[model samples]
Target: MKIIADLHTHTIASTHAYNTILEMVHYAAQAGLKAIALTDHGRRMPGAPGDWYFQNLATVPRRLEGVLVLRGIEMNIIDYEGNTDLEENAKNLDWAVASIHGGLMDPNVKPTVELCTELWLKVAQNPMVRVIGHSGTPQFAYDYEKVIPEFGRQGKLVEINEHSFLVRKSSVPNCKKIAEVCKKYGVPIVVDSDAHFCTELGVYPNAERMLKEIDFPEELIVNGDENRLYEYLRKYTKVLEEE
Candidate 1:
């Protein structure tokens, strides 16, 4: 189960992440990846890049280091209402991954399973959202039976983020559960490194392991097939048309 493109990765523009865009692209090229997304954290996260950084992504050529570079943002989901911190200007990016981060949510709100389910359902309907990032964290488990199907209907890729195993191990059980439901519903999924550094680009051992365990259908994995990924990009984004 090899992925030709990693659709969620971070660069030094994300502050906490350690390498530059070129550096990350270099690693992707080295890994023989066909494409990679530079999805920096949105402004709501502490030290996250500002609007200018994301809005000006046009300057970063679509092709870099012999790899297709997807300019994107990992926006922070801010409330149970499913409002994200994505800047208006960054809305047109080639890709977007909306996720709940412990540090960025409303401090006053306590997330219940029902509330998280509602939030994700709303996010699923969001046209701007391309990928549902690392959902069903231990603390943010939603109603998988209901929401996963909606995600499928909305054409949102449910991410099986490899980074969760390394940094958010507590979410592993829920991640497996999400994958099971995804397979049952025949929902398309994306496997991403969610890397914070160049060295981590195209790394997906954990996500691949989980998918293999459940015998998840390979054709349903967008990043696993280059032509399928290009078709998806051309369908929902201006990527191919940009030429």
Candidate 2:
């Protein structure tokens, strides 16, 4: 299953990420990708960009290097109540990926399976949240059976983050479990490189292998084909409309 677009990539704007937007887009063009999203981290994460950074995304063209460039942000889910660190300026972005990152939440507040489940359910209802980033982290594990279907109903694309396999090795097992439940519920999913560098863009070997193992339906993968990717953008975002 080849993905024509990668909807979760990072750039130098994210600090920890190494390449610039032009570098990333140039790589995508060379890779023959039809689209890519520049989803920098929200302010809550250490060294993450500030409000003006997101508010000024309009300056970035909708298309770069003949590839669709989605102005996006990966906001941290800060609490069990589903509150995220997304700034008001983020409303102008073309996409938003919400995820629970370790150390971003309160230290004293423990996360229970029930609380995690509730948290994701609430996030699923958020209109601005289009992608659910790496929900397989063991520490933030939630009810896959209950939450996957809700995500499908709310039109949220569950992400199969390739970076997790390399960085958060422990989440592999849970990630597989999440993929299984997603297949059972026919929930749409997105495979992303979650790349921190230009060369990493559009790379999805591990995630693709995992999904193929479970025979996950390719049609349900939003970025698996160009037609599917465009359909999703047209239906759920103003990216195409503005273009």
Candidate 3:
């Protein structure tokens, strides 16, 4: 399946990430992608951009270098209760990806299957969440059978993050299992670069191989087709409202 849009990525504003927003968008355009989401890290992440950075995202044009730019934030999930470090001006953004990052969670809230499952269930119900970003980390594994369906029911796209293969190697096996469970439940998903640098933008060889090995259905991947992605954004996000 061809992913016409990459729905998760990072820029220099995220500190550890190495590219600027325009650089990332330019790479997407050159890669022939129809769209890309510039999702910088949330405030709680060490060195993450200030609140003004997200609030001022309105100044970014909806389209850049012929590629649709989704103004988004990767809000860190901070507790077992599914609370996120969501900015107060979240309404100003076009997309939000809820993720559990190491070291950002509450110290008292341990990672148990039940707790993680509950966390994801609550995240699924959050109106601000569009993507359930990279939930297959071994430390934060949830009940795939229960939560995958709930994610679909809530219109949240489960992510198959390519970056995990590089940085979170131990999670790869679980990620494949998660994808298999998603396929079994007919849960729609998105494959993202989760790119921290310009060169990583729109790159998905590892993700594609895994999905193909599982014989994943093309239609169930929301960003696999340009129209399918546009349809989703129109329904769940205001990004297309002015287009």
Winning model by TM-score: 2
**Residue pairs in steric clash, candidate 2?**
none
Provide the TM-score for each candidate, comma-separated: 0.98, 0.99, 0.98
* C-alpha root-mean-square deviation, candidate 1: 0.9
Candidate 2 — which residues are off by over 4 angstroms? Answer: none
**Could you tell me the C-alpha RMSD of candidate 2 in Å?**
0.7
> How far in Å is the alpha carbon of 73 misplaced in model 2?
0.2
Task: List per-prediction Cα lDDT, in the order shown.
Answer: 0.90, 0.92, 0.91
Which candidate number would show the highest lDDT if scored against the true structure? 2
Query: What tens digits encode model 3's per-residue C-alpha lDDT throughout 197-227?
Result: 8888788998999999999999999999988
Which stretches in model 1 have alpha-carbon errors above 4 Å? none
Off by over 4 Å in 3: none
Q: Looking at model 3, which ten-residue stretch has the lowest summed lDDT?
A: 102-111
lDDT of 3 at 226: 88
User: For candidate 2, what is the lDDT?
Assistant: 0.92
